[model samples]
Target: MAKEGDGADSIVAATITDDAPTKAISSQGMESINATATAMTKAKNAIVVVEEACTSSKKPEEPKNPKTQVLIVPLRWMSLGMTRAKQQLVLLLAMRLRTVKTQMMTSKLQEVKAEADEKLKSISGENVLLQINCKALKNENAKLFKGYDDLEAKYTSMKALVKEKIKAAKSQAEAFKIELEATKGTNAESISKVAELLKSPPGFFKKQVKEYTTMVSTHILLVAKYLYPRIELEAIGEGYADGTSEEQALKLINDINGVATSIFNESLDL
Candidate 1:
């Protein structure tokens, strides 16, 4: 009985030693699980703090207003009033320009009328002067025609007188020729008788010859006095009508007088 009791005590001692080691190992594993749970809780707290900082830093949105819609009505009315005022100002300016243009055109018309009146007055004065000049020219022409008629009448009378004088001179020349022929036929007795008669009536033939010469000279002087002036006047008038100068007309008159004087002297000599 004493051996059996000693073996039971040893077996019980070994079983208690094994149960103590297993309980210590289970306690260390439970400590590691508690540390991991604490770290997970700290990470969840830091993520929540970051989300709150970002949200607080963002700009806020603008709020909508009901008064903005009401203000738009007054602004539209003001714009329409400004447009009507501009149109009124433009119309007034156009009317003023038209009035100014009309005034300028009227002034120009008046000036033209005044100038036309002055021109008409000048033309009337010139017409009057021309009429006066024409009247004077007509009077001068009438006088010249009267003078020409008188000259022509005088020339006709002179021609008739000259014809009568020439006929008388021819009769006298024939008589003288017959007396000369008769005297040529007379002899010495007839010549002595004629000499005795001439001595008794002294200067009878001389007086007759002197009277005939005086008559012929008077006739020739009368013809020259009347005809020479008429010839000069006619020549001067013709030169004037032909647009000759006064100096040229006078020169022509002198030439005609010289030619007439030479002709008259030649006729007298003959």
Candidate 2:
């Protein structure tokens, strides 16, 4: 009985001597701590009661049989030792609970940090892809603008050339009319035929004009196909019909502008 009490005392002393680091805890943890403290307090009171009983038993008493004294002494000592052991076990259990809670909290924090890192990596990857796509669009836009400028320059030059040719043709026609008036008396038939030719274009010129109209139509069709793949051209015109929302009409207009601009730019490149 003495040995048991000494062992219990040693364990209690060791547990008390160890440093328990202080930590901030939540309301739930505080409740657990309060419950454990209450249990320890009860165990301490039990120990006090057992000690008092043992002390009272030790006091001098009326004469009794030697066998009875021996039995009573051992029993008292056993009860005291058992109470001390129970008190220490309660303390031990409280400490174990605190340690386990700390470990669980630490593990939970590590898991949260790991999940945050994974989400950050995914967002970074998406940002990189967006950046790459933006750069590609910028490059394409630059090329389109360059092509548009070149096409504009060519159109300006052709317009100037056509104006000059028309001016030259008008000057020649006026001079020929002045000469024809002087020659009409000697060559009346020839003059009449030349006048008729001047009034109406030759058949070859009409054929050339027709071929030009067809070529322009074909080019327009090709541009439309390039700009709006998998969509019917008639559907675009239908978008402007009755019951179309204003926003939808505006979107269609913008789409048409984009297609026309793209076609013009591409033609300049060619």
Each model's lDDT: 0.51, 0.58
RMSD of 2: 25.8
Clashing pairs in 2: none
Which sections of candidate 1 miss by over 4 Å? 1-88, 185-189, 192-270
Off by over 4 Å in 2: 1-91, 188-270
Query: Whole-model lDDT for model 2 versus the true structure?
Result: 0.58
Instruction: Count the clashes in each prediction.
Output: 0, 0
Over 1-270, each residue of candidate 1 has an lDDT whose tens digit, in order, gives 112223323323433344343343344444543443343233443223322322333322222333222111221222333333222222222233334445657888889989999999999999999999999999999999999999999999999999999999999999999996675534445547966765666487867655655665455556766877655544433536667775575556545666655655665676
What is the C-alpha lDDT profile of model 2 across 134-173, one tens digit per residue?
Answer: 9999999999999999999999999999999999999999
